[model samples]
Target: MVSKSRSEWSTILSHLVLAAVSLHAAVTSAQSSRGAAAGFLLQTFAAITMLVPGLNTHEDCLAGAWVATVIGLPLLAFDFHWVNGDRSSANLLLGGGMVLAVAGDHLGPEGCSVAGQAVLLVVSVTILIVAVFTANTYGIWGGAMLGVAGLLSRLEEDRLLLLPKEDVCRWALTAGSWAYCRALHTQRLQWE
Candidate 1:
Protein backbone atom coordinates (compact mmCIF):
# COMPACT_ATOMS: atom_id res chain seq x y z
CA MET A 1 0.00 0.00 0.00
CA VAL A 2 1.20 3.50 -0.81
CA SER A 3 1.37 6.05 1.92
CA LYS A 4 -0.37 9.39 1.27
CA SER A 5 1.35 12.69 2.03
CA ARG A 6 0.02 15.35 4.38
CA SER A 7 -0.94 17.58 1.45
CA GLU A 8 -3.02 14.83 -0.10
CA TRP A 9 -4.79 14.17 3.16
CA SER A 10 -5.56 17.86 3.54
CA THR A 11 -6.90 18.03 0.03
CA ILE A 12 -9.25 15.15 0.69
CA LEU A 13 -10.52 16.69 3.91
CA SER A 14 -11.09 20.02 2.21
CA HIS A 15 -13.17 18.42 -0.48
CA LEU A 16 -15.33 16.75 2.14
CA VAL A 17 -15.99 20.13 3.73
CA LEU A 18 -16.65 21.59 0.32
CA ALA A 19 -19.33 18.99 -0.26
CA ALA A 20 -21.23 19.96 2.87
CA VAL A 21 -20.94 23.67 2.16
CA SER A 22 -22.12 23.25 -1.39
CA LEU A 23 -25.11 21.22 -0.26
CA HIS A 24 -26.14 23.87 2.23
CA ALA A 25 -25.77 26.57 -0.36
CA ALA A 26 -27.90 24.56 -2.76
CA VAL A 27 -30.68 24.15 -0.30
CA THR A 28 -30.65 27.79 0.80
CA SER A 29 -30.56 29.16 -2.73
CA ALA A 30 -33.16 26.87 -4.20
CA GLN A 31 -36.19 29.02 -3.47
CA SER A 32 -34.59 32.17 -4.81
CA SER A 33 -32.45 30.88 -7.68
CA ARG A 34 -33.03 27.39 -8.90
CA GLY A 35 -30.24 27.62 -11.45
CA ALA A 36 -27.63 28.53 -8.86
CA ALA A 37 -28.99 25.93 -6.51
CA ALA A 38 -28.75 23.26 -9.16
CA GLY A 39 -25.20 24.26 -9.89
CA PHE A 40 -24.30 24.04 -6.22
CA LEU A 41 -25.97 20.68 -5.91
CA LEU A 42 -23.93 19.32 -8.81
CA GLN A 43 -20.77 20.67 -7.23
CA THR A 44 -21.71 19.02 -3.97
CA PHE A 45 -21.87 15.69 -5.71
CA ALA A 46 -18.54 16.26 -7.39
CA ALA A 47 -16.87 17.12 -4.10
CA ILE A 48 -18.37 14.14 -2.34
CA THR A 49 -16.96 11.80 -4.94
CA MET A 50 -13.50 12.72 -3.72
CA LEU A 51 -14.20 10.89 -0.49
CA VAL A 52 -14.11 7.49 -2.18
CA PRO A 53 -10.69 5.85 -1.81
CA GLY A 54 -8.66 5.82 -5.02
CA LEU A 55 -11.69 7.05 -6.97
CA ASN A 56 -10.08 10.33 -7.84
CA THR A 57 -7.44 8.48 -9.82
CA HIS A 58 -10.06 6.99 -12.12
CA GLU A 59 -10.53 8.58 -15.54
CA ASP A 60 -14.31 8.31 -15.36
CA CYS A 61 -14.38 10.03 -11.98
CA LEU A 62 -12.21 12.85 -13.26
CA ALA A 63 -14.48 13.23 -16.27
CA GLY A 64 -17.56 13.32 -14.10
CA ALA A 65 -16.08 16.07 -11.93
CA TRP A 66 -15.17 18.10 -14.98
CA VAL A 67 -18.66 17.65 -16.35
CA ALA A 68 -20.11 18.92 -13.09
CA THR A 69 -17.82 21.97 -13.06
CA VAL A 70 -18.33 22.87 -16.72
CA ILE A 71 -22.11 22.81 -16.38
CA GLY A 72 -22.23 24.24 -12.87
CA LEU A 73 -20.12 27.34 -13.60
CA PRO A 74 -22.36 28.44 -16.44
CA LEU A 75 -25.49 27.92 -14.37
CA LEU A 76 -24.04 30.01 -11.55
CA ALA A 77 -23.07 32.78 -13.95
CA PHE A 78 -26.44 32.79 -15.68
CA ASP A 79 -28.33 32.83 -12.40
CA PHE A 80 -26.22 35.66 -10.96
CA HIS A 81 -26.81 37.84 -14.00
CA TRP A 82 -30.49 37.04 -14.11
CA VAL A 83 -31.06 37.68 -10.43
CA ASN A 84 -29.33 41.05 -10.68
CA GLY A 85 -31.55 41.95 -13.68
CA ASP A 86 -28.58 42.18 -16.00
CA ARG A 87 -30.03 40.39 -18.99
CA SER A 88 -27.20 41.38 -21.23
CA SER A 89 -25.12 39.48 -23.76
CA ALA A 90 -23.39 37.69 -20.86
CA ASN A 91 -26.43 35.56 -20.21
CA LEU A 92 -26.54 34.48 -23.83
CA LEU A 93 -22.85 33.66 -23.73
CA LEU A 94 -23.25 31.65 -20.57
CA GLY A 95 -26.15 29.70 -22.03
CA GLY A 96 -24.35 29.03 -25.26
CA GLY A 97 -21.17 28.02 -23.47
CA MET A 98 -23.10 25.60 -21.24
CA VAL A 99 -24.77 23.98 -24.22
CA LEU A 100 -21.46 23.70 -25.99
CA ALA A 101 -19.85 22.18 -22.90
CA VAL A 102 -22.60 19.57 -22.57
CA ALA A 103 -22.35 18.68 -26.25
CA GLY A 104 -18.57 18.49 -26.07
CA ASP A 105 -18.76 16.22 -23.04
CA HIS A 106 -20.98 13.76 -24.86
CA LEU A 107 -18.94 13.78 -28.07
CA GLY A 108 -15.46 13.86 -26.57
CA PRO A 109 -13.36 11.05 -25.13
CA GLU A 110 -14.19 9.12 -21.96
CA GLY A 111 -11.93 11.46 -20.04
CA CYS A 112 -11.58 15.22 -20.38
CA SER A 113 -10.45 16.40 -23.80
CA VAL A 114 -8.47 19.48 -24.81
CA ALA A 115 -11.60 20.99 -26.33
CA GLY A 116 -13.47 20.49 -23.07
CA GLN A 117 -10.64 22.10 -21.12
CA ALA A 118 -10.67 25.08 -23.47
CA VAL A 119 -14.41 25.49 -23.01
CA LEU A 120 -14.05 25.31 -19.24
CA LEU A 121 -11.33 27.94 -19.28
CA VAL A 122 -13.32 30.25 -21.49
CA VAL A 123 -16.44 29.90 -19.38
CA SER A 124 -14.48 30.50 -16.17
CA VAL A 125 -12.82 33.65 -17.51
CA THR A 126 -16.15 34.94 -18.78
CA ILE A 127 -17.66 34.48 -15.34
CA LEU A 128 -14.75 36.33 -13.76
CA ILE A 129 -15.26 39.24 -16.14
CA VAL A 130 -18.94 39.35 -15.34
CA ALA A 131 -18.28 39.29 -11.62
CA VAL A 132 -15.77 42.10 -11.96
CA PHE A 133 -18.18 44.26 -13.89
CA THR A 134 -21.05 43.54 -11.51
CA ALA A 135 -18.91 44.16 -8.40
CA ASN A 136 -19.63 40.83 -6.78
CA THR A 137 -16.97 40.28 -4.16
CA TYR A 138 -17.61 36.61 -3.51
CA GLY A 139 -17.92 35.84 -7.19
CA ILE A 140 -14.80 37.78 -8.00
CA TRP A 141 -12.74 35.80 -5.48
CA GLY A 142 -14.35 32.48 -6.36
CA GLY A 143 -13.85 32.94 -10.09
CA ALA A 144 -10.25 34.03 -9.63
CA MET A 145 -9.47 31.04 -7.43
CA LEU A 146 -11.20 28.64 -9.82
CA GLY A 147 -9.29 30.14 -12.73
CA VAL A 148 -6.06 29.45 -10.90
CA ALA A 149 -7.26 25.94 -10.09
CA GLY A 150 -8.01 25.30 -13.76
CA LEU A 151 -4.57 26.48 -14.79
CA LEU A 152 -2.91 24.43 -12.10
CA SER A 153 -4.79 21.32 -13.14
CA ARG A 154 -2.99 21.46 -16.46
CA LEU A 155 0.29 21.22 -14.57
CA GLU A 156 -0.62 18.10 -12.64
CA GLU A 157 2.73 16.51 -13.31
CA ASP A 158 4.56 19.42 -11.76
CA ARG A 159 5.38 19.87 -8.11
CA LEU A 160 5.91 22.86 -5.82
CA LEU A 161 7.81 22.48 -2.58
CA LEU A 162 6.95 18.93 -1.48
CA LEU A 163 3.41 19.01 -2.81
CA PRO A 164 2.10 18.07 -6.23
CA LYS A 165 0.34 20.57 -8.47
CA GLU A 166 -2.84 18.56 -8.16
CA ASP A 167 -2.95 19.14 -4.43
CA VAL A 168 -2.62 22.88 -4.89
CA CYS A 169 -5.29 22.75 -7.55
CA ARG A 170 -7.63 20.92 -5.20
CA TRP A 171 -7.04 23.51 -2.50
CA ALA A 172 -7.80 26.33 -4.89
CA LEU A 173 -10.95 24.56 -6.02
CA THR A 174 -12.09 24.12 -2.44
CA ALA A 175 -11.58 27.78 -1.66
CA GLY A 176 -13.40 28.74 -4.83
CA SER A 177 -16.31 26.52 -3.98
CA TRP A 178 -16.52 27.94 -0.50
CA ALA A 179 -16.64 31.47 -1.84
CA TYR A 180 -19.26 30.48 -4.39
CA CYS A 181 -21.43 28.96 -1.69
CA ARG A 182 -21.10 32.10 0.35
CA ALA A 183 -22.20 34.10 -2.65
CA LEU A 184 -25.26 31.92 -3.04
CA HIS A 185 -26.08 32.04 0.64
CA THR A 186 -25.79 35.80 0.74
CA GLN A 187 -27.99 36.16 -2.30
CA ARG A 188 -30.60 33.95 -0.71
CA LEU A 189 -30.54 36.04 2.45
CA GLN A 190 -31.01 39.15 0.39
CA TRP A 191 -34.16 37.73 -1.14
CA GLU A 192 -35.62 36.94 2.29
Candidate 2:
Protein backbone atom coordinates (compact mmCIF):
# COMPACT_ATOMS: atom_id res chain seq x y z
CA MET A 1 0.00 0.00 0.00
CA VAL A 2 2.81 2.37 0.83
CA SER A 3 4.44 1.64 -2.48
CA LYS A 4 1.22 2.36 -4.29
CA SER A 5 0.89 5.65 -2.47
CA ARG A 6 4.44 6.56 -3.39
CA SER A 7 3.71 5.71 -7.01
CA GLU A 8 0.69 7.96 -6.97
CA TRP A 9 2.76 10.82 -5.62
CA SER A 10 5.29 10.28 -8.36
CA THR A 11 2.54 10.39 -10.92
CA ILE A 12 1.37 13.70 -9.55
CA LEU A 13 4.89 15.07 -9.69
CA SER A 14 5.20 13.95 -13.29
CA HIS A 15 1.99 15.76 -14.17
CA LEU A 16 3.24 18.89 -12.43
CA VAL A 17 6.39 18.77 -14.48
CA LEU A 18 4.35 18.43 -17.68
CA ALA A 19 2.27 21.41 -16.62
CA ALA A 20 5.38 23.51 -16.19
CA VAL A 21 6.74 22.46 -19.58
CA SER A 22 3.44 23.22 -21.26
CA LEU A 23 3.23 26.63 -19.60
CA HIS A 24 6.73 27.46 -20.77
CA ALA A 25 5.91 26.31 -24.27
CA ALA A 26 2.83 28.48 -24.30
CA VAL A 27 4.78 31.52 -23.19
CA THR A 28 7.49 31.03 -25.78
CA SER A 29 5.08 30.20 -28.59
CA ALA A 30 3.12 33.36 -27.87
CA GLN A 31 5.89 35.53 -29.35
CA SER A 32 5.26 34.30 -32.88
CA SER A 33 1.76 32.80 -32.87
CA ARG A 34 -0.90 33.59 -30.37
CA GLY A 35 -3.12 30.78 -31.64
CA ALA A 36 -0.55 28.11 -30.98
CA ALA A 37 0.32 29.72 -27.67
CA ALA A 38 -3.30 29.56 -26.61
CA GLY A 39 -3.39 25.88 -27.53
CA PHE A 40 -0.37 25.23 -25.36
CA LEU A 41 -1.92 27.24 -22.56
CA LEU A 42 -4.99 25.04 -22.70
CA GLN A 43 -2.74 22.01 -22.66
CA THR A 44 -1.10 23.39 -19.53
CA PHE A 45 -4.49 23.61 -17.92
CA ALA A 46 -5.23 20.00 -18.87
CA ALA A 47 -1.94 18.86 -17.36
CA ILE A 48 -2.56 20.84 -14.17
CA THR A 49 -5.88 19.06 -13.77
CA MET A 50 -4.03 15.78 -13.56
CA LEU A 51 -2.46 17.05 -10.34
CA VAL A 52 -5.84 17.00 -8.66
CA PRO A 53 -6.30 14.12 -6.24
CA GLY A 54 -8.02 11.08 -7.72
CA LEU A 55 -7.62 12.51 -11.18
CA ASN A 56 -8.25 9.30 -13.04
CA THR A 57 -10.88 8.16 -10.63
CA HIS A 58 -12.85 11.38 -10.98
CA GLU A 59 -15.13 11.62 -13.97
CA ASP A 60 -15.39 15.38 -13.93
CA CYS A 61 -11.64 15.91 -14.04
CA LEU A 62 -11.28 13.43 -16.86
CA ALA A 63 -14.00 15.18 -18.80
CA GLY A 64 -12.38 18.51 -18.21
CA ALA A 65 -9.10 17.29 -19.63
CA TRP A 66 -10.86 15.92 -22.68
CA VAL A 67 -12.71 19.15 -23.20
CA ALA A 68 -9.53 21.19 -23.03
CA THR A 69 -7.79 19.00 -25.59
CA VAL A 70 -10.81 19.08 -27.83
CA ILE A 71 -10.67 22.85 -27.85
CA GLY A 72 -6.89 23.25 -28.09
CA LEU A 73 -5.98 21.08 -31.07
CA PRO A 74 -7.49 23.39 -33.68
CA LEU A 75 -5.60 26.34 -32.31
CA LEU A 76 -2.41 24.39 -32.67
CA ALA A 77 -3.37 23.54 -36.22
CA PHE A 78 -4.03 27.21 -36.87
CA ASP A 79 -0.46 27.94 -35.93
CA PHE A 80 0.69 25.08 -38.10
CA HIS A 81 -0.90 26.87 -41.04
CA TRP A 82 0.45 30.23 -39.91
CA VAL A 83 3.98 28.90 -39.94
CA ASN A 84 3.86 26.86 -43.14
CA GLY A 85 1.52 29.03 -45.22
CA ASP A 86 -0.33 25.87 -46.21
CA ARG A 87 -3.60 27.77 -46.69
CA SER A 88 -5.50 24.53 -46.95
CA SER A 89 -9.07 23.89 -45.84
CA ALA A 90 -7.83 21.29 -43.38
CA ASN A 91 -7.83 23.86 -40.62
CA LEU A 92 -11.55 24.26 -41.06
CA LEU A 93 -12.01 20.53 -40.72
CA LEU A 94 -9.92 20.56 -37.59
CA GLY A 95 -12.01 23.32 -36.11
CA GLY A 96 -15.24 21.61 -37.06
CA GLY A 97 -14.13 18.35 -35.50
CA MET A 98 -13.21 20.08 -32.27
CA VAL A 99 -16.51 21.89 -32.12
CA LEU A 100 -18.33 18.60 -32.55
CA ALA A 101 -16.17 17.11 -29.83
CA VAL A 102 -17.03 19.91 -27.43
CA ALA A 103 -20.69 19.61 -28.22
CA GLY A 104 -20.66 15.87 -27.73
CA ASP A 105 -18.90 16.24 -24.43
CA HIS A 106 -21.33 18.81 -23.11
CA LEU A 107 -24.63 17.95 -24.74
CA GLY A 108 -24.57 14.34 -25.81
CA PRO A 109 -24.72 11.11 -23.87
CA GLU A 110 -21.75 9.42 -22.23
CA GLY A 111 -21.04 7.40 -25.32
CA CYS A 112 -21.05 10.58 -27.30
CA SER A 113 -18.10 11.88 -25.36
CA VAL A 114 -16.14 8.77 -26.26
CA ALA A 115 -17.11 9.15 -29.90
CA GLY A 116 -16.11 12.77 -29.76
CA GLN A 117 -12.69 11.88 -28.41
CA ALA A 118 -12.28 9.34 -31.19
CA VAL A 119 -13.09 12.03 -33.74
CA LEU A 120 -10.59 14.41 -32.20
CA LEU A 121 -7.93 11.73 -32.18
CA VAL A 122 -8.48 11.09 -35.86
CA VAL A 123 -8.30 14.80 -36.60
CA SER A 124 -5.07 15.11 -34.64
CA VAL A 125 -3.55 12.20 -36.51
CA THR A 126 -4.54 13.73 -39.81
CA ILE A 127 -2.80 16.96 -38.84
CA LEU A 128 0.28 15.00 -37.90
CA ILE A 129 0.26 13.26 -41.26
CA VAL A 130 0.16 16.65 -42.92
CA ALA A 131 3.09 17.75 -40.80
CA VAL A 132 5.05 14.71 -41.87
CA PHE A 133 4.26 15.30 -45.53
CA THR A 134 5.34 18.91 -45.14
CA ALA A 135 8.62 17.77 -43.57
CA ASN A 136 8.02 19.56 -40.29
CA THR A 137 10.38 17.34 -38.34
CA TYR A 138 9.70 18.80 -34.91
CA GLY A 139 5.98 18.77 -35.46
CA ILE A 140 6.09 15.15 -36.50
CA TRP A 141 8.04 14.20 -33.41
CA GLY A 142 5.77 16.20 -31.16
CA GLY A 143 2.67 14.66 -32.71
CA ALA A 144 4.12 11.19 -32.36
CA MET A 145 4.92 11.73 -28.69
CA LEU A 146 1.48 13.13 -28.02
CA GLY A 147 -0.02 10.16 -29.86
CA VAL A 148 1.89 7.87 -27.56
CA ALA A 149 0.59 9.80 -24.60
CA GLY A 150 -2.94 9.39 -25.89
CA LEU A 151 -2.42 5.69 -26.30
CA LEU A 152 -0.98 5.43 -22.81
CA SER A 153 -4.00 7.23 -21.42
CA ARG A 154 -6.14 4.28 -22.51
CA LEU A 155 -3.99 1.92 -20.51
CA GLU A 156 -4.65 3.49 -17.15
CA GLU A 157 -5.70 0.15 -15.73
CA ASP A 158 -2.33 -1.30 -16.60
CA ARG A 159 1.01 -0.79 -14.87
CA LEU A 160 4.58 -0.97 -16.05
CA LEU A 161 7.55 -1.51 -13.71
CA LEU A 162 5.14 -0.86 -10.86
CA LEU A 163 4.51 2.72 -12.01
CA PRO A 164 1.08 3.85 -13.13
CA LYS A 165 0.42 4.47 -16.82
CA GLU A 166 -0.41 8.06 -15.98
CA ASP A 167 3.22 8.72 -15.16
CA VAL A 168 4.32 7.55 -18.57
CA CYS A 169 1.56 9.58 -20.17
CA ARG A 170 2.69 12.68 -18.35
CA TRP A 171 6.27 12.19 -19.46
CA ALA A 172 5.17 11.74 -23.05
CA LEU A 173 3.03 14.85 -22.87
CA THR A 174 5.92 16.89 -21.47
CA ALA A 175 8.22 15.76 -24.26
CA GLY A 176 5.54 16.39 -26.86
CA SER A 177 4.93 19.92 -25.65
CA TRP A 178 8.64 20.68 -25.64
CA ALA A 179 9.02 19.33 -29.15
CA TYR A 180 6.04 21.38 -30.30
CA CYS A 181 7.60 24.52 -28.86
CA ARG A 182 10.78 23.81 -30.74
CA ALA A 183 8.77 23.20 -33.91
CA LEU A 184 6.96 26.49 -33.55
CA HIS A 185 10.11 28.42 -32.74
CA THR A 186 12.05 26.97 -35.65
CA GLN A 187 9.26 27.42 -38.14
CA ARG A 188 8.69 30.99 -37.03
CA LEU A 189 12.40 31.66 -37.54
CA GLN A 190 12.20 30.37 -41.09
CA TRP A 191 9.11 32.45 -41.79
CA GLU A 192 10.80 35.64 -40.67
Candidate 3:
Protein backbone atom coordinates (compact mmCIF):
# COMPACT_ATOMS: atom_id res chain seq x y z
CA MET A 1 0.00 0.00 0.00
CA VAL A 2 2.78 2.39 0.91
CA SER A 3 4.65 1.84 -2.31
CA LYS A 4 1.48 2.10 -4.33
CA SER A 5 0.66 5.40 -2.74
CA ARG A 6 4.15 6.58 -3.48
CA SER A 7 3.80 5.51 -7.07
CA GLU A 8 0.59 7.43 -7.47
CA TRP A 9 2.18 10.52 -6.07
CA SER A 10 5.12 10.02 -8.39
CA THR A 11 2.75 9.93 -11.30
CA ILE A 12 1.10 13.12 -10.19
CA LEU A 13 4.44 14.77 -9.75
CA SER A 14 5.53 13.66 -13.19
CA HIS A 15 2.42 15.16 -14.72
CA LEU A 16 3.07 18.42 -12.98
CA VAL A 17 6.60 18.46 -14.26
CA LEU A 18 5.48 17.74 -17.77
CA ALA A 19 2.91 20.51 -17.67
CA ALA A 20 5.41 23.00 -16.33
CA VAL A 21 8.08 22.05 -18.84
CA SER A 22 5.67 22.29 -21.73
CA LEU A 23 4.45 25.67 -20.60
CA HIS A 24 8.02 26.81 -20.36
CA ALA A 25 8.79 25.64 -23.85
CA ALA A 26 5.67 27.33 -25.11
CA VAL A 27 6.62 30.59 -23.53
CA THR A 28 10.11 30.38 -24.94
CA SER A 29 8.78 29.64 -28.38
CA ALA A 30 6.42 32.56 -28.26
CA GLN A 31 9.18 34.97 -27.40
CA SER A 32 10.13 35.16 -31.06
CA SER A 33 9.51 33.60 -34.45
CA ARG A 34 13.02 32.21 -34.67
CA GLY A 35 13.00 28.48 -33.91
CA ALA A 36 9.29 28.71 -33.15
CA ALA A 37 8.48 25.49 -34.99
CA ALA A 38 10.59 23.39 -32.66
CA GLY A 39 9.20 25.15 -29.63
CA PHE A 40 5.66 24.63 -30.84
CA LEU A 41 6.23 20.91 -31.30
CA LEU A 42 7.72 20.57 -27.84
CA GLN A 43 4.91 22.56 -26.31
CA THR A 44 2.30 20.47 -28.07
CA PHE A 45 3.72 17.15 -26.89
CA ALA A 46 4.26 18.34 -23.35
CA ALA A 47 0.74 19.78 -23.08
CA ILE A 48 -0.80 16.48 -24.21
CA THR A 49 1.37 14.36 -21.93
CA MET A 50 0.54 16.61 -19.02
CA LEU A 51 -3.03 15.38 -19.16
CA VAL A 52 -2.08 11.71 -19.05
CA PRO A 53 -2.34 11.47 -15.26
CA GLY A 54 -5.96 12.53 -15.25
CA LEU A 55 -6.95 10.09 -17.99
CA ASN A 56 -7.40 6.83 -16.07
CA THR A 57 -7.80 8.07 -12.53
CA HIS A 58 -9.55 11.36 -13.16
CA GLU A 59 -11.71 11.17 -16.22
CA ASP A 60 -13.59 14.41 -15.71
CA CYS A 61 -10.42 16.39 -15.31
CA LEU A 62 -8.92 14.56 -18.21
CA ALA A 63 -11.83 15.49 -20.40
CA GLY A 64 -11.43 19.14 -19.64
CA ALA A 65 -7.69 19.04 -20.18
CA TRP A 66 -8.12 17.21 -23.45
CA VAL A 67 -10.67 19.70 -24.66
CA ALA A 68 -8.43 22.58 -23.80
CA THR A 69 -5.33 21.00 -25.35
CA VAL A 70 -7.02 19.94 -28.56
CA ILE A 71 -8.54 23.32 -29.16
CA GLY A 72 -5.85 25.56 -27.76
CA LEU A 73 -2.85 23.97 -29.50
CA PRO A 74 -3.99 24.58 -33.04
CA LEU A 75 -5.26 28.03 -32.30
CA LEU A 76 -2.09 29.01 -30.55
CA ALA A 77 0.10 27.60 -33.32
CA PHE A 78 -1.82 29.32 -36.06
CA ASP A 79 -1.88 32.60 -34.19
CA PHE A 80 1.85 32.37 -33.66
CA HIS A 81 2.31 32.64 -37.38
CA TRP A 82 2.26 36.13 -38.82
CA VAL A 83 -1.08 36.73 -40.50
CA ASN A 84 -0.40 39.96 -42.39
CA GLY A 85 -1.27 41.94 -39.28
CA ASP A 86 -0.45 42.12 -35.58
CA ARG A 87 -4.05 42.49 -34.44
CA SER A 88 -5.07 39.19 -35.91
CA SER A 89 -2.41 37.24 -34.06
CA ALA A 90 -3.18 39.03 -30.82
CA ASN A 91 -6.86 38.34 -31.15
CA LEU A 92 -6.33 34.71 -31.94
CA LEU A 93 -4.00 34.10 -29.00
CA LEU A 94 -6.39 35.85 -26.68
CA GLY A 95 -9.24 33.59 -27.68
CA GLY A 96 -7.11 30.48 -27.54
CA GLY A 97 -5.67 31.30 -24.13
CA MET A 98 -9.11 32.06 -22.76
CA VAL A 99 -10.39 28.69 -23.91
CA LEU A 100 -7.46 26.99 -22.24
CA ALA A 101 -7.98 28.86 -18.97
CA VAL A 102 -11.66 28.05 -18.73
CA ALA A 103 -11.12 24.40 -19.54
CA GLY A 104 -8.42 24.20 -16.92
CA ASP A 105 -10.94 25.15 -14.25
CA HIS A 106 -12.77 21.88 -14.76
CA LEU A 107 -9.63 19.86 -14.07
CA GLY A 108 -10.46 19.22 -10.44
CA PRO A 109 -9.81 15.87 -8.79
CA GLU A 110 -13.32 14.36 -8.85
CA GLY A 111 -14.31 16.68 -6.03
CA CYS A 112 -12.91 19.76 -4.40
CA SER A 113 -9.23 19.21 -4.82
CA VAL A 114 -7.25 22.39 -4.32
CA ALA A 115 -4.06 20.94 -5.76
CA GLY A 116 -5.88 19.89 -8.88
CA GLN A 117 -7.36 23.33 -9.26
CA ALA A 118 -3.96 24.90 -8.84
CA VAL A 119 -2.58 22.76 -11.61
CA LEU A 120 -5.29 23.94 -13.97
CA LEU A 121 -4.64 27.51 -12.94
CA VAL A 122 -1.00 27.06 -13.77
CA VAL A 123 -1.90 25.71 -17.16
CA SER A 124 -4.14 28.64 -17.86
CA VAL A 125 -1.46 31.08 -16.81
CA THR A 126 1.01 29.37 -19.05
CA ILE A 127 -1.32 29.81 -21.96
CA LEU A 128 -1.67 33.48 -21.17
CA ILE A 129 2.09 33.85 -20.85
CA VAL A 130 2.55 32.47 -24.32
CA ALA A 131 -0.07 34.80 -25.70
CA VAL A 132 1.56 37.78 -24.05
CA PHE A 133 5.00 36.96 -25.37
CA THR A 134 3.80 36.22 -28.86
CA ALA A 135 1.20 38.90 -29.30
CA ASN A 136 0.54 42.19 -27.54
CA THR A 137 -2.59 43.72 -26.06
CA TYR A 138 -4.55 40.66 -26.98
CA GLY A 139 -2.14 38.53 -25.03
CA ILE A 140 -2.44 40.74 -21.98
CA TRP A 141 -6.17 40.51 -22.23
CA GLY A 142 -5.93 36.76 -22.49
CA GLY A 143 -3.85 36.73 -19.32
CA ALA A 144 -6.39 38.91 -17.60
CA MET A 145 -9.21 36.63 -18.60
CA LEU A 146 -7.34 33.67 -17.20
CA GLY A 147 -6.68 35.56 -14.00
CA VAL A 148 -10.29 36.60 -13.58
CA ALA A 149 -11.53 33.11 -14.29
CA GLY A 150 -9.12 31.63 -11.81
CA LEU A 151 -10.20 34.11 -9.18
CA LEU A 152 -13.88 33.50 -9.75
CA SER A 153 -13.37 29.77 -9.70
CA ARG A 154 -11.58 30.02 -6.38
CA LEU A 155 -14.35 32.12 -4.94
CA GLU A 156 -17.02 29.75 -6.14
CA GLU A 157 -15.21 26.74 -4.76
CA ASP A 158 -14.81 28.27 -1.31
CA ARG A 159 -13.19 31.33 0.15
CA LEU A 160 -10.99 33.20 -2.27
CA LEU A 161 -7.26 33.02 -2.73
CA LEU A 162 -6.33 31.75 0.71
CA LEU A 163 -8.75 28.83 0.68
CA PRO A 164 -10.14 26.43 -1.89
CA LYS A 165 -12.39 23.41 -2.36
CA GLU A 166 -13.33 22.71 -5.97
CA ASP A 167 -11.76 24.38 -8.99
CA VAL A 168 -14.03 26.39 -11.20
CA CYS A 169 -12.27 27.76 -14.31
CA ARG A 170 -13.36 30.68 -16.54
CA TRP A 171 -11.81 32.50 -19.41
CA ALA A 172 -13.20 35.93 -20.01
CA LEU A 173 -14.20 35.21 -23.54
CA THR A 174 -16.02 38.51 -23.47
CA ALA A 175 -13.08 40.38 -22.07
CA GLY A 176 -10.66 38.87 -24.59
CA SER A 177 -12.89 40.03 -27.42
CA TRP A 178 -12.98 43.50 -26.02
CA ALA A 179 -9.22 43.54 -25.76
CA TYR A 180 -8.90 42.51 -29.36
CA CYS A 181 -11.00 45.45 -30.39
CA ARG A 182 -9.03 47.81 -28.23
CA ALA A 183 -5.77 46.52 -29.65
CA LEU A 184 -6.97 47.09 -33.15
CA HIS A 185 -7.94 50.62 -32.37
CA THR A 186 -4.53 51.30 -30.90
CA GLN A 187 -2.79 49.77 -33.86
CA ARG A 188 -4.73 51.99 -36.21
CA LEU A 189 -3.77 55.06 -34.21
CA GLN A 190 -0.08 54.08 -34.24
CA TRP A 191 -0.15 53.51 -37.95
CA GLU A 192 -1.84 56.85 -38.56
The Cα local distance difference test for each model comes to 0.70, 0.71, 0.44
**What is the per-residue lDDT of model 2 for residues 10-126, given as tens digits with 9 covering 90 to 100?**
777887887798799888888788987887888788777766666655666666566556667667767776556665644775567577655764565566546544644554575
True-vs-predicted CA distance for residue 36, candidate 2, Å: 1.2
Task: Give one clash count per candidate, in the order shown.
Answer: 0, 0, 1
For candidate 3, the lDDT comes to 0.44
TM-score of 2: 0.79
Which candidate, 1 or 3, would have the higher lDDT against the true structure?
Answer: 1
Q: Report the backbone clash tally of model 2.
A: 0
Query: In order, what is each prediction's RMSD in angstroms?
Result: 3.5, 3.4, 14.0
Q: Judge candidate 1 at residue 88 and give its lDDT.
A: 74
Better TM-score candidate (1, 2): 2
Q: Supply the global lDDT for candidate 2.
A: 0.71
**Candidate number with greatest TM-score:** 2
Cα-lDDT of candidate 1: 0.70
Question: Is candidate 1 or 3 superior in TM-score?
Answer: 1
Worst 10 residues of 2 by lDDT: 115-124
Model 3 regions more than 4 Å off = 1-66, 69-108, 111-120, 130-135, 156-174, 177-192
Better of 1 and 2 by lDDT: 2
